[model samples]
Target: MLFDLHEAAANRVSTTQRRNTTTGASAASAMASSLTASRANGLGGLDTAFTSTEDLNCKENLEQDLGDDNSNDLLLSCPHFRNEIGGEYERNVSFSRASAGSPGGSECRLAEPALSTYRTNASISVLEVPKEQQRTQSRPRQYSIEHVDLGARYYQDYFVGKEHASYFGVDEKLGPVAVSIKREKLEDHKDHGPQYQYRIIFRTHELITLRGSILEDATPTAMKHGTGRGLPLKDALEYVIPELNIHCLRLALNTPKVTEQLLKLDEQGLSRKHKVGILYCRAGQSSEEEMYNNEEAGPAFEEFLSLLGEKVCLRGFTKYAAQLDVKTDSTGTHSLYTTYQDYEIMFHVSTLLPYTPNNRQQLLRKRHIGNDIVTIIFQEPGALPFTPKNIRSHFQHVFIIVRAHNPCTDNVCYRQLLSGQTLPCPHCVPEHVPSHCSSHWRNDLLMWLLPH
Candidate 1:
């Protein structure tokens, strides 16, 4: 199962992660070499060379109640999209055809145990643009690598696209907020002795940490987590914010059908098994070679907002899954987390939807799954697919189809990049697409979505 240098580079894992420390800097160097070679051969998707064009046209203060949260202003608009936030739509929903020939298809294992308190999606709306890039022409994409005096490095990749997925946790003070991965930096923190902070940096540049007692390996023997007061981070943010950044709302207006579906998903209610959308972690590097070798170095791209895709096997798409234990209560609270690699990848329920391709053939081409390029499916929990299924399909049936990406909102981030507002990866977008998806896309996904 040999992969191309470009594809492999497009999905590179973190070389500096402490877990990889055993392999040391040499392995990192090898990865760099591979990335360099791949870039030379041409392959920088979202990670390398990708930048947001919206930054140039957008204004500075997007959260100042300019006009309306759903404002249709060119520069300032609502960013709230209509994905999986609707109520449960199990009303006779079933797949048109059974998994008669679906290769990766399997029985439905997801079942709702109880929901004393749960969140379909966050309802908050706050996004702002950066001032520096407003005055100048678009600049080259780059990363912020800060070197502290403590012989440690804190690097944040800035050149990524639409934050399709997000991490969430509860704050002792602010209740709950979005979280960003701190990576394996146990020794870097001087005050806290080897602890990871699930923190969210708002558009206001406020770093809020969702406080909770940390547990290791999330073992069966670990102490139970305490249920705190008020709404969980996701709900709290949703409660405070009334609308999406106006930018997203305007984009949704243009795509009424998808917007309608998003509203439907939301009304139906969102769950791990029946999510309306899926997130991808784009993997690549920002290098001149990457820029030169790749034609998609520009910002129009939005797919795979890089993180750790290798860590995502086929959870919703296949029998292989990552366990996400959920516990909710009537006190407007819920807790969800997944234990992986001797650590828990915690999460708060939210909403998402991705139309990676307008048509099936295009999807195959983008993933390089054609004749010479065979996309091998591994049952391993961490070996996820390039394009994953949004919801868990049951043995009897499943419903819903892919929603086309909204061009108006695809490349643009909710706010400014510096404000921690990331854009969605908009790759595989048709240069001159029709007003909506073509007939082939809707006729039936069985041809492409299901295995032969």
Candidate 2:
């Protein structure tokens, strides 16, 4: 099937990476392409560009992090990561869902085994902002062209030949999955061009090699991945994801109850599955009329805070356990659900509840239905105090669910992405995202949340 441009972009670079292009010249940086204007944050100071050797060192640093011993290791590893035909390597291409649905999906496959190491030669040039604009801004202005050189040194280290899918504990099967990078805007640029224009183009082999290794780890083969009792999904859940209090979670199951619980309600109060309640207290054990009515007697602030403790039932309705709901999209006709609670405390729940409309739709719009399920973890808005006791408690709850729910025996689900950190998946062959997902984005969440 064809991949979405935005999804394809995210698949390429990994959310953990900071994509910055540095050129050899100290010339001023330029604005991102017109397409990137909407997403551009601001110019990455290109006036202070990296020298060529320094650039190489940056690439080396990334390689070392991926476990490569040296540059020699990168080249030898390239061929094994990418497919070869007639003694030459085949360049992988990106495709949309419609285009990918065809036979060429085989072309998108990574070279058998994938590379263990990667290298790249990315360069960034400075984009100059006009003086008139600069005066108005009163700050140093520069744009950048981050080359991001990526290639592998050893191709043979990963596999012998022929694409084979190892059953990682919790990964989707390695079929015709495409990979691409997305450049999201980190700041606004007002100098040379539109403040937020960027483009996501194809990445070199270096990025692809490293990305493949990361992806491999995320797949099921990296988990409880051996020929054995073939434990069902419930058992695998523990190994795949163990925490859930901050983010709304998603889990796919065969039961109707499980399916119905993941939806969104509109004008109708909560969907049939939802429950609500208002904080109230029993006054005196002696009489019913004497009971403390939160609406009339209890503290307002306390009752308001109680919203976090209890589910909000439909107006005047009976209390319902906040379950997941499923609904269709107004535009794409895709199905999704509303989140059960605010972001701060989603992980506290044992079961996966929908956090956003997109996540819920992913479950309902799945293209393939293997006997596997998916779990998504997210953090709520406020700071969730982390305590040793609470951490252990949360883990225990996750472990229990995994032990009871998953169905796969030999195969277990693996991680596509984890909560706090962002990184590239290793299975994908690096390529560029088209017109859809190129803009500047800063990976560090701290940078995003801190007071500017």
52-123, model 1: which lDDT tens digit per residue? Answer: 343211212121221122211111121211111112111111123331122222121122233323222111
Q: Cα RMSD for candidate 1?
A: 27.5
Off by over 4 Å in 1: 1-32, 35-277, 280-435, 438-440, 443-447
Worst 10 residues of 1 by lDDT: 146-155
Candidate 2 lDDT over residue span 1-452, tens digit each: 12132343454455335454221110001111211332232254333234245444444323211111111200111100111111122222222323322233433344433322322222211223324444342211111111112112111212213121111121231112211211222243355322221121212222221122211123354443222333343323333232211122233333444222211110122122322111122222111111111122223222222222333322232233222222322112211122322211111122112123434233321211111111222211121211111111111111000010111222221111111111211122223211111111111111111111
Q: Evaluate all candidate structures by whole-model CA lDDT and list the values in order.
A: 0.22, 0.22
